[model samples]
Target: MRAVYILPALFVAGVVALSSVYIVDERKQALVLQFGQVKQVVEEPGLGFKLPFIQEVVSYEDRILGLPTQPIEVTPADDRRLVVDAFARWRITDLVKFRQAVGAGGEEVARQRLDRIINAAIREIMGGVPSTAVLSEDRTALMNRIRDIARRESGSLGVEVIDVRLTRTDLPEQNLEATFARMRAERQREAADEIARGNEAAQRVRAAADREQVEVTSEARKNAEIVRGEADAQRNAIYAEAFGRDPEFFAFTRSLTSYERAMQSGNSSIVLSPNSEFFDYMNGVTAPVAPEVPAAGQ
Candidate 1:
């Protein structure tokens, strides 16, 4: 009978002990609440104590978190509308403040609210900058401005914004076709200019080549004339020298040469007179002999 009573007493003690203790993981912090009022705050990891059956613990994450907002359309200072999508890295810094502000709504609700703050900040900053600035090197400065603003504005929600970034920015669907058409036209104009420049250069080269050809041909003709004149003068000089050596012999040889050329073919026709000077040698009529001259003594 005493053994049975001892078992019942031990079981009662076990229930009481289980309700008094709670385990907090390394990744979490806890708040002990009683009767809907805050009774204790547990930040450290491992086992913790709470009133049995009457107190409850609410756990909150103590690590960095992410909040991604949906893509939204924004107009820039240049009046260009763009579709923008962004995300933010954040974490709950003040547990007491966080719980007081939005603990009941939990992490999901907090994220929703954060999305609004980030979107509003993005629009405000992006709207003041030109589209070119957002797309150029100045984009870095614009993003920094946005992050600073989001961080400052998120402080009221007991959250710290670590970084803010835009993932994508592009023209709206309705504008894509028009933009592409304009780009094609610009490219075609550039191509036409390049072709015109190339043609001009080619014309200059062709004109130079034609001029050089004309100069070369004229110089060749001039050189040919000079060579022919030299040859004619040389032939005349040789004839004059031969005649001075022996005039009669020279005339006889010339007649013989002309006769040989005229009689080359048996059926060849000749219209010259038989006694013509050309046939003097062939007719056996030799050149006149020089009259003998007497010595001075005779």
Candidate 2:
């Protein structure tokens, strides 16, 4: 009868011990709750204890967590509507406040509240800026602003927002075609203007080259004519000098030249008189003989 009682007591103690002991994972935090109220908070990972059969433990992720927001439409200052998809990094900072705020709903409830806060901040900040700013490098600043807003709002939920990011920002599908068409038209108009300007410049250059060519050709012709005229005058002067030095010899040479020109044709029909001056040199009748002079000794 004693051994039987001892065995029953040991079983009861074992059951109580198992109920009081809990293991906390390194990546998680825990809360000790008694009668639906938070009794103790356990942030560090280790073995923890609780009152048997009355208290229980609730675990929450201690590491950074992610919350991906659904794609939402936002109208910017330019009135261009865009579809924005974003996500946030957050972590539970105060488990006591977290449990108090969300009650028995746990992290899921906190996440739902966080989602609302983030979406509201995104709309408020993005609506004030133009779509260009949202798509530009300034987007980082906008995200920071969003994170700050979310951080402030989420403080009540006992969570700290580490960062917020816009994963994708784009025009609505319905507006994509219209925007692309407008951009293409603008680019084409610019290209046409560039082409027209290039053509005008090329024409100007061609005109300059043609004018230069004409001027050069005209000047070269003028110089050539001047040289030809000077050559003709020099030849006339030489002829006159030769004639003045010996009239008879010049006449004889002129007669020989005339005869050669008249008979230069292989087929020659001379219809001139035998005494014609052109034939004087060939006839040898007009030849002049010089008178003999006495020697100096005589």
Candidate 3:
């Protein structure tokens, strides 16, 4: 009977010992509750002791958790609709507040609150900027606003919001295709204009070369005519001096030349006056000498 009574007490002590001690790691927060009521919160890493069987320990993540906010279709101030992908990194900053307002380690409830806060922030800040600016030059400012608003709104929820960032912003495919077509057409027009200017320059060069060729050929022909005229004048001056020295021989020579030309090619008709230059060598024919025969076998 004594052994049985001691045995039950020892078992109870063991259970109490097991339930009293709780450990909080460096990356976690611990919450202590007594009979469903908040007792003490452990925000630092250590061993925490609580009442056995009546007290409960709840653990929370001390490090940042990535929470992807719901993608919402929002129209910017310029009335362009886009889907916004936003997420935040946060951690539990207050263990007491986490257990008091919302249940400790209540990820679902926390996510619901974040969703509300993030949506409200997007509507106020990102939705106010034009779609062009939100997706481009003003994206940094918009992200800053979202982070600020989320931090402020979540401060009371025992969560510390580190930052918010946008993942993607895009124009619809149809819009992108139309933009490409316009860009291509503009480039083609510029290329065509350049080609036209090039062709015009080439034509000008060719025309100038053609005109230069014509001028050079004409100058060469004129120089050739001048040389031929000088040669002809010199021949006439020599002929007149020769004819003055021996008029009769010159006439006879000239007539003989004309007769030789006339008899070489024709037995055709001819017309002449009696006193014409063609008669200058008529009736003054000379006999030709025959070759002498060789004596036989001398």
Across residues 1-298, which tens digit of lDDT does each residue of candidate 2 receive? 8999999999999999999999999999998889988889888899999999999999999999999988899999999999998999999998888888998888889888999999999999999999999988667789999999999999999999999999989999999999999999999999999999999999999999999999999999999999999999999899789879986787777665555565565554557677755555667766542222222222
Q: For model 1, how does the per-residue alpha-carbon lDDT over 1-298 read when each residue is reduced to its tens digit?
A: 9999999899999999999999999999888989867888888999998989899888888888988898899999999999987889988887777777786886787798889888888899999989887767547777778889888887878789888888888999999989999999999999999999999999999999999999999999999999999999998898779888988887766665655565565555657677765555667777643222222223
Go through the candidates in order and give each one's C-alpha lDDT. 0.83, 0.87, 0.77
List TM-scores for all candidates, in order: 0.81, 0.77, 0.68
Task: Write down the RMSD of all candidates, one decimal each.
Answer: 8.3, 8.6, 9.5
- In the predicted model 2, the residue pairs found to clash are none
Which of the two, 1 or 2, has more TM-score? 1
Highest-scoring model, TM-score:
1
Better of 1 and 3 by TM-score: 1
The number of clashing residue pairs in each candidate reads: 0, 0, 0
Location of the lowest summed lDDT over 10 successive residues in candidate 3: 289-298
Q: Which stretches of candidate 3 lie over 4 Å from their true place?
A: 1-9, 205-298
- Count backbone overlaps in model 1: 0
Model 1, position 50: C-alpha lDDT score: 91
- Number of the candidate with higher lDDT, 1 or 2: 2
Estimate, for each residue in 95-195, the C-alpha lDDT of model 3 and write its tens digit.
67766667743866887898889878987886777888777855777888888998899988878888888876665565677868999999999999999
Give the range of the ten consecutive residues with the poorest summed lDDT in model 1.
Answer: 289-298
